[model samples]
Target: MTEHQDAQGQHAPTTPPAEPAVKSAGPSPEMLELAGRMFDAARTGDVDTLEAYIVAGLNPDLQNGKGDTFLTLAAYHDQPAVVEMLIRVGADVEKANDRGQRPLTCATFKGDAASMRLLLAAGADPDAGTPSARQTAQMFGGERVAAVLDEAR
Candidate 1:
C-alpha cells in the first residue's frame, strides 16, 4: 500500500463532488412568437406584412426550427418576390441552414434560373465552401446556373 493508504490498507482517492446539471435557458416567449410570425410571413409571401414586421423592429435574419432563414424559406417556397424583398431588407443571402444550404442553393436545387440570377446579381457568393450554392447547382444539373456562375468568374 502507498503512504497515503487508509489504516485498513486501502488507497483513498481524493476528488471534488460533481455539480448537478443545470436547466438550459431557452428562447423567450416574445422571440418565439416573433419567429412564428416571421415563418408565416415567409411561407405566405406576405411582403407587406413582412415589411411591417421588419420596420417594427423584427430581425430580418430570423430563422425557423430548421435553422432556415426567411430568405431560404422564400426561395424554397418559390417566392422570388419575397426573396427580393427580404434581401432588400438586409437578409443574409449566403446564410446556410442546418443542411448547409443557402437561399441560392435552394433556388439552384429547384432549377429556378431566374431566382439564381437574382441572387447572383445581389452578390451572393457562388464560390462559398463545400456544399455551396455553386456546387449544389452543379449537382442538381442546372446547366444555366453553372454557365452563369462560370461567366461571373
Candidate 2:
C-alpha cells in the first residue's frame, strides 16, 4: 500500500491500475455465412430456410443495413406465405425501412394482391410509413389492392 505523491509532494492515496481493454472476437466466418444465407432466403422466399433459422434463434425481424426487414423483403418479393410466417412469428407488421417503406406498401407497389391481403389480415396498418399502402395501390392503379385496403379499413 505505497502512497502516491503529487507534483507538490503531497501524499495521495494510490489507485488500482485499470485492466487492459479486451478485444471483441467479432462475428465468426460461420456466423457471417449464415447471415448471408438468411438474407438470401428472405430475398428468394425460401420459407423453410428462414423458418429453420428463426427456430434456431435468429431474430425474425432481422434487418439488413438498409433497414429492410425479412418481412419487407418477403412482401416485396410477392411471397405471401413467407410474409404470413414472419407475421405469425411476431415480426413487426409496421416496421419501416430507411426510406419509410413498409411491407404492405411494397406488396401494393408490386401488385401482389395475395401479399397485400396477407399483410392486411395480419393487422398491418395500410397508412403506415411514407407513401402508404393505400397510396401505393392508388399510384400503381391496382384496383383490387385498393378494394382490399378499403375492406380492411
Query: What TM-score quantifies how close candidate 1 is to the native fold?
Result: 0.73
- Model 2 residue 138 CA deviation in Å: 1.8
Clashes of each: 0, 0
Which is the leading candidate under lDDT?
A: 2
**What residue runs in model 1 are displaced by over 4 Å at the alpha carbon?**
1-34
- Per-residue lDDT over 55-105 for candidate 2, one digit per residue giving the tens place of the 0 to 100 score: 889998888889999999998988888988898888999999999999999
lDDT of each: 0.79, 0.87
Q: How far off is residue 42 in model 2, in Å? A: 1.5
TM-score of 2: 0.84
Error of 2 at 23 (Å): 2.6
